[model samples]
Target chain A: GAGVSQSPSNKVTEKGKDVELRCDPISGHTALYWYRQSLGQGLEFLIYFQGNSAPDKSGLPSDRFSAERTGGSVSTLTIQRTQQEDSAVYLCASSLTSGGAHETQYFGPGTRLLVL
Target chain B: AQSVSQHNHHVILSEAASLELGCNYSYGGTVNLFWYVQYPGQHLQLLLKYFSGDPLVKGIKGFEAEFIKSKFSFNLRKPSVQWSDTAEYFCAVRAYNNNDMRFGAGTRLTVKP
Candidate 1:
């Protein structure tokens, strides 16, 4: 079975440009998450999606950051007018259920975004 | 706001040596604790988790963690470590009813052969 996967393993862009990172969750998974990891730092939660309900965007750093999960299977995180501080590794994860009690999230290899 | 802390930033040990990594959380409510590991050039993988029941939980790769509710701690331990165990370890915590999860700064372990 395919695990959580993210495309564009590496991306280099200007500080003022916008970039979109994509993620494909495992089949049958109803929970998806996006996180950002700075160099030598831990994961920082960005957004979460559970089934057809509204996505949780509380973890998003700013309005410039937005994410969408279409059809409840694939997700895309877009950063508008990216700043140098936005450069980091973007990781995606998915779990079988949305319950926080026993959900074991599986992570992806991550996309390393570099803002020059 | 909830947060997680990992005391050790980096650790180095020889093969067959015992290993222990400390993890603590600030949330007072019911929270799920987890330990994840990431090997070189590999994705993060779950090492263990403590949702309920037994406080002492065993995980893959001869690893285990003890969740001490009294101290708000979930420390990971391995009696004997192998060189392959060298990797980065992260401690995470999430509230039982919330979707947001917090992670520690991570501890990098290096095992000498």
Candidate 2:
């Protein structure tokens, strides 16, 4: 409850279907981030939300991917038309503030997404 | 653009053995360094970080890392490891004033009893 919480610890869906992953960050945290960890690959930055500033979606692999943080607390990452390559561990993290010289990010038990 | 590299993909060690995992990054500007651990079936937890002050920083569970700015290296070390230490480790960094913290591939460490 105190830490970042992600829904559907595990989800398996058929290819070409859409999937939405949710993340609830710690209270008072203003900065939220989404990352993907593919098998044997590193954690890839997917998106970042800072306060009210425009989210940096530079890491989204394609236009098919998008995310939104409503009310600065709950965030969701949606993958449209999932493919085999879309299977990975979806991780969510949040920091106390969006900006600062150095801030630690608390992570959640990633949601394991599988596309069949 | 910034990226992180973990030298060893897999490392095997015996109980009480010394351990070191190398991490390097390519970034021209200032950055913050961090090491996170993920035990089997657990979420990623912060092991340590290097923001400023001492380059050689100590972290939880008797872990430590030294940030070598000139070489752009931040390596994790443990004097003695135990079987319970087996886990996946990740290194990350964020720009001097940025919100994005890029992560390294990750090193799987298995300490045998």
Candidate 3:
């Protein structure tokens, strides 16, 4: 039903501050994703959006990381200047578009970010 | 760098016992395997997936997985285990011509009943 939905489950910025993480996809999900889960690092893959052409930042890990997917759904993942290694646990996922079909992402209950 | 290897970060059993969990990955071509579960704070569910003809795949509740392309592995088993099947197990890999997906650094099962 209503799955993927993330927000500030927890965030505590400090180092060079600049954070914004949100994602709400699943009303008709046309695909949207952003992942991060540090601490020995595992699930990492930062940007993606389908159904609107451009956006596959190729696992964005630099450029202060950036992400956006609006109009097709809500998604945001901006981590400008934030460091301390950008903390971790920022995950959002959705599926239902991406042509090749293998759908099944649906996740959200993450947003730990803590860079003190 | 398509990596995914969950060589057990933690696993303690007791319930009905019997359950294996080990996933290995490192692409060079086709791949699509998954086994995700997270029952503590919840949010990451999908107990099975192995995009190809049986290599021993069955999922949900009494999960199963075994896709061994020689040893790129994709292990996850269960013969009996329940303490609510303690949680946190993730093993993912995607690249069949893709937008990318990779995960695995999780394995926290703790089934003690």
DockQ (model 1, Cα): 0.82
lDDT over C-alpha atoms for residue A64 of model 2: 93
| Chain A TM-score relative to the true structure, per candidate | 0.97, 0.96, 0.33
Clashes of 2: 0
| Candidate 2 lDDT, B1-113, residue by residue in tens | 88999999999999999999999999989888889999998889899988889899999999999999999999999999999999999999888777667899999999999
**lDDT (0-100) at residue A42 of candidate 1?**
83
TM-score of chain B of 2: 0.98
What residue pairs are clashing in model 3? none
lDDT of each: 0.95, 0.92, 0.86
Q: Candidate 1 chain B: minimum summed lDDT over ten consecutive residues — where?
A: B92-101
**Candidate 2 off by > 4 Å:** A99-102
List of clashing residue pairs for candidate 1: none
Which whole-number lDDT from 0 to 100 does residue A7 have in model 3? 88
Q: TM for chain B in all models?
A: 0.99, 0.98, 0.33
Model 1 stretches astray by more than 4 angstroms: none
Q: Interface root mean square deviation of every model, in Å?
A: 1.2, 1.6, 9.9
User: Which candidate leads the pack in TM-score?
Assistant: 1
For candidate 3, write residues A1-116 as lDDT tens digits. 57888888999989998999989988988888888999865788888898788988988989988888889899888998898978989988888866353678888888999999
Candidate 2 local lDDT, A1-116, one digit each (tens): 58999998999999999999999999999899999999998899999998998999989999999999999889999999999999999999998865453477889999999999
